[model samples]
Target chain A: MIARLRDGLAVYFCLLRGALAARMTDRADLGISMIIMLLADLVVPLTTLLVYQHGAGFTGWQRDEALLLQATFLIAKGIAFPFCFGMIWTTTELVREGTFELLLLKPRSTLLLLLGHSFQPEDTGKLLGGIALFCLALPNVTIGADADSSAALLGFAALLLLAVLTLFGFALLMTCLSFVWIGNSRLQEIFDAVSAFALYPHGIFTRSALGWLTWVIPVSVLGYLPASVLLGRPDPALPLAVGGALCFVLVVIGLWRMMLARYASAGG
Target chain B: MNRLLAAWRSTCAIAYATYQEWAAYRSHMLISLFIGPTYFLVQVVIWQALLADGGTIGGYDRTALMSYYGAVLIVSTLVFDFADWNLQMLIRSGKFLTVLLRPMSHRGFALSQKLGHRCLGLWMEALPIWLILWLVFSIRLVPASTGWFVLSLALGFLIMFLVNYCVGTLAFWLTRTAGARRLIGFLRDVCAGVFLPLALFPHELQQLLFFLPFQFITYVPVQVLLGHYELAGIRLGIPEIVGCQALMALLMWGLSELLWRLGIRRFSAAGA
Candidate 1:
């Protein structure tokens, strides 16, 4: 099992390196794309800033705290987008052009191969923006150095991992949809709209909406839950939300397998 | 007069054909019905919580803020243009040569295509989203003055097309323009008051945005719809601002034409 894991890592890194090399052919475009990715994600945070500056804010959340929550979402997106999210678009194009069979013929797991080959270096701008905002906001918020702070840090770390996994699940789900949906480029826009709810404080949402976000859609895991945990104000439903996120990922994986089985290649 | 009539007829034909071509992707357009409302819902939740105490932000009460966002969604649906993306793809793949071979100006053809696409969007995206905003959100988007609003919105549409066309012109020089296009497009949207109202911006930033051509695209139209125009401490009646929007549209047309002339000289689709 260890040997197989090592082999998988080796294959993933090799394919990632190739993707990087291909993207490096256009360094200027790569740099601009990265900046664009960063700027695009910063829009919500900017609006939050302007709102607070204008003496309005999400109830129960301070300006910096709200920024921190949005920063957490951006960081999660920063991590997932460059790594996993490209699979959706790649699958769309590959399937549309009847070239998806090329990936299927590889000896490696098709999922692994697809994930590896779809690395997007430009999206690292999102990571940079997130980290920058995180650093900027972390200084302003108070965190006691007591045991609870430590526990909160631990919970935040765990929830952040779950957040990344949740995003991966979403990417996987969209990729699976792309198999049959064909030529539909608005999948990302739909995801963008849904996940946008994660950028704000949970206090802003109505009880029903909050329940849906936490228990059904697992949107809370993407940012709000992790940020809340780090703020040392963990939601009472944290454990349940975590479980929902895990189940969501598991369901997505199952869906991916079913779709793969159904994918009677474009036969290019 | 006969030549002008022929131009009008061909424009209509092109628009109708483009509309039919895109009707196959109506489901794609219908997705906006979901996305627009979802976004508005998020805004609703946030603003409802913020102003629950009866506090106003930037001189807007909850009702006015809701109207602003609702108008934004509707106007955005009407004036939306992907001409930049379409044109860049054409240029990159050397498919624009086919356009040049046609008698009509590529700009005119692209505008006709946008008209067709937006006609579809008006029904599939704008109208339904308008109903959702009205029926579900209880946000009534009664324009301050209907005639001036319509005129301003038409100007907004023209400005948006000109700006995107100029961005597409960059593909003639750059081997890859996706990043540049996105960067410019995003900045344009930001300045145009898409994500946040211009009133929410700092005084200095608002002043700077006033000089930029983008606010003519969405901000002016929304403000005209809302029946008030004030940004960066400058106030204008609907007629005056709409006039300014028209002037900006003409300026954008001149800029786009200049860029097209300069960029077209660089086009080399020898093999393609």
Candidate 2:
């Protein structure tokens, strides 16, 4: 499995490089896409900081801690970007245009093939922004600098990767809804709308009934729960992060397999 | 006067025809209805959370925030224009030539058609949600001052329409206005207090955003409806909100018309 995964990663990178090469011909679009992405990354955190400092401090987390949550969101978006962002919309077009059939004849799983084909080169900027924000925000966590706790930090990093995987799984689930709701672009718009809710600090929703939504939907887990755990906030429910990730993986794989059986390929 | 009346009547007829075309897609309309409500519900949930801690944000309490967001959902749906998207498509497909040969003014036809679509769309999707919120949430209204609210909303609509037209006109030169649209949308969402109350923005940013036109389209009308302005009962304060909205509306409308003329001239010269 590890070998296959490595091979898949190698193939994915090669395909991504090809896409980047193709995108380079359209340098103007690439430049605009980069600027938009940089602006998106900058605006969210800045808006949060402005809103919190002006209105009231965040309910559960301080400014630096909230920035960490924002960083987690950017990182999750970065991880999902290379794989999901381009494919979600393009998949609908493929299905509508009956071009998806060309994808199924490939040697690999169609999911992996689609994932490899749909890389957005501009998201590299987003990924770098996420890392920069994470690094900048990292120092604000008051955890003592002890060499022994490096293991816990490593564990946390692993959990963060799991969180990204879960987010991708969920995004895939939303995109796959297009297969079921064919010809209705409103589903895509609705997904965009719901995803907008994830842009803010999840601690804002602490006592509301929709707080369950943050956990069950794992929108907050993409940022809030992992950030909270890493910041060493006392929460007995920290283990749920691992559980959510596992469930997300299992459910997403299960759903994709089920849908794969029903996918009638659009002629390429 | 008769000519103007006839033009208005013909415009209304075209609008009705467009509405009928939209109505033909029942499944699409139903899906839109479902999506619209769900989107508003999510906004409500977010605002509820923001106000959950019983803390004041920008001097807005929980109920006030709910009323503001609920009003925004309704007002935005009502005033929203899709002419930008339409303009982009027209420019890309070179459909403006067809409009240029028509008897009526292109801008007039485009604006009226959008107005008709908005009216039809609101009746189909937004009105029910607005009524439900009003009844269920006891959303406060600026009663006996219906004129003030209506006039403010009109100004808001004009601002929204002009801004969309201006942004869409950029497509003539830029080839693709999606980037501009996205940036505009982001700015609008933040500054117009669509996601949260604009008051929550830092005083500096809020002041800066006041110079930008997005606030006129969404925030002001919502504020008017929620009776945020210092007006005593039974007194009309249309001038305050309406004045600002009218000024911005005129500025944006003038700028958009200028751009549209220049853009069309460029396209004509290029034979695009």
The global C-alpha lDDT for each of the candidates, from Candidate 1 onward, is: 0.90, 0.71
Residue pairs whose backbone atoms clash in candidate 2: A98-A266, A98-A267, A99-A266, A99-A267, A101-A266
lDDT of 1 by residue, B1-272 (tens): 99999989989999999999999888789889899999999888888988888889998888889899899999988999999998889988988888899999999999999999999998899889988988998877888789998899999999999999999988999988889999999999999999989898889999999988999999999999988999999999888988888888889999999999998899988422
By summed lDDT, which 10 consecutive residues of candidate 1 chain A come out lowest?
A142-151
TM-scores vs. true structure, each candidate: 0.97, 0.85
List runs of model 1 lying over 4 Å from the truth: A144-146, A266-268, B270-272
Clashing pairs in 1: none
Candidate 1 lDDT, A1-268, residue by residue in tens: 9999999999999999999999998899999999999999999898888788878888778898999999998999999999999999999999989999988888999999999999999999999999999999999986533437878888887888899999999999989889877878888888999998999888888799999999899999999898988887778998999999999999999999999888887721
lDDT of 2 at A6: 92
lDDT of 2 by residue, A1-268 (tens): 9998998888888877887898777677677776677667766677567656756555666777778877877887787776676777667777878777787787776777777778887776677778888898888776423433555466557767876787677667856776776555565566555555565555555455335544566565666666665665524555764575578678878987787788866421
Each model's DockQ? 0.86, 0.34
Error of 2 at A101 (Å): 2.4
Q: Which lDDT tens digits does candidate 2 get at residues B1-272?
A: 99989998988988888788777655655665556666666656555655567876667777776777778877888787878888877886888778788998777787888777777768776676777676766664443367777888888888888888888888888866666776776667667777667776656777687777888888888878776552112233556766877889989988987998798877862235
